[model samples]
Target: MRILLDSFVSFFRNNYMQLAAALAYYGMFALLPFLLLTALLLGKSITSSQEALEGLHRLTYQMVPEFQAVIFNELISLSRLSDTWGWVGIVSCLSCIFPLVVTIRNVFLTVFSAQRKRPVMIEILRDFSTTIFLIVLLIFLVISQIIYDELIIRFFMAISFPLYIVDFMVNLTISTVGMTVFYYAFIPVKVGLKHICVGAVLTSVLWAVINPTLVFLLKLNPKFGIAFGSLKTVFLIFMWVYFSFCVIVFGAEFIAQWDRRKEWGILSTKHGKNGVKETSPPLERDPPSLTP
Candidate 1:
């Protein structure tokens, strides 16, 4: 327990929290164009573009209920304007997603460092692929929700079971898997599977708890929406992304802390060889060893 507490302290002392805050700012900047381009692509894949549009709307509203009207209205406008945006416009928006993706890659590398930095082109390719991965993941989630509603519910009803429980479990499992994929793929370094799995599950649970509580609290101030008016959704979107970035970065930092502590023999397991993987990067200066 002491070791765990110290790990968190180290995480703060290292100023990873500040890094997370920077990520939130950049993430908010990226979200608008990224989502716009994503929705455009998703619309192309589906039978109806409107359905794709609504899926994004529904997912956003579920996460941040306070901005339901705002998201819905903005999405509607975007949908209408989608036709006006030419290939050049679409390509331009997508190019803008590169910086956010690259920033995220750098953050992950900084948090869970490798022996040395990889090539810049390789990093760029990885980050660009990550952008596509996220859009595909979102589409899969939307489709999964549709499947659960249209088909899975019927199976549970036939067995006389409360399906909402099933729905919750399924959603939770999917969220965990999605988070695990992000941590595993984005970090650009080797970490123990145990650490990655724990980080993913912790992030999912933390997000589940924080997002709803935030929604409720934000709803208490109804004046925010009226005051911001049409811009309410934009503000709320930034808030949601910002908080989420903080949670995810904290989780990564916590896992990195655990790795550091483990290497120094601070948090030893009873078993002769614990499952966590350890790395001994050759630091140019003194190592990042914690003081007694």
Candidate 2:
């Protein structure tokens, strides 16, 4: 309980909400480009562009059902735009995702309190590497989902198993694993898999709750977005992104706080301070102090 409370307090004290809001803003700008890049890369594989689009659409729907159509339509538009721009468009799309990745990396460093000591060139290369890694990971997950849906899902249905249970479990496992990788990759601190897995599980569970709660709220109040007029969709999408970042930031904080518990006497501290002494006095100190 004390650890949880400290994490919560540290979350706000560290200005995590502001960090989340910043991520949401960058994410909005990067969304279309990231999707376009994904489709373009997947086009080189066995998957047809249309199939890729469908897979991306399904992923988006599962993530934010309320705003999936808006996102999908934009992805379609970007695909058309890419046809004329050629390599330049692809390069631009690739570049656009960097800012978001960099923001995420910085956010992780901040949450974990990892210092930035690497050279600028190294940092840029790392950012680029992380971007490509994440993009590839996204494509991999999408393709895997496509295969799983066609194969595993069919088999389950043929066996008369409950589809919802299968879906929920599959999604939960995927979410947890993906988040675990994300937390490990982004955090500048060298964290153990156990700590990250715990944080990832927490994040995945909270993230799973988000979509259903949003869907239920929208269903219960279909006109809830009307107050925003024409920008209702945009507003909702931004809020969804913001909420996601909040969960991510909180998970990172949880991991940091959990690591702190390993320090000797940390749990016994009343104010959550490190109770271990930096340097202990010698057990047999000379009496030279009295002579002096």
Listed in order, each prediction's TM-score against the native is 0.77, 0.85
Alpha-carbon RMSD to native, per candidate: 6.1, 9.4
**lDDT tens readout by residue for model 1, 178-288:** 778778877765678788788778777888788788877776876665667888667677777777887788777767766665665543443326766644322222223
- Each model's lDDT comes to 0.67, 0.76
Model 1 compared with the native: what TM-score?
A: 0.77
- Report the lDDT tens digits of candidate 2 across residue range 1-292: 7666777887776667888888888888887787768876776442335556667887787667788898878777766654465777877877888888888887776666565699989999998999888888788777867776778799999999999999888888877888898888898877779989999998889898987898888889888878899998888888888888888888988887777555424445533455543432111211111100
Clashes of 1: 0
After superposition, the stretches of candidate 2 with alpha carbons farther than 4 Å from their true spots are 44-51, 80-82, 264-292
lDDT of candidate 2 vs native? Answer: 0.76
Mark the 10 consecutive residues where model 1 has the least summed lDDT: 283-292
Point to the candidate with the largest TM-score: 2
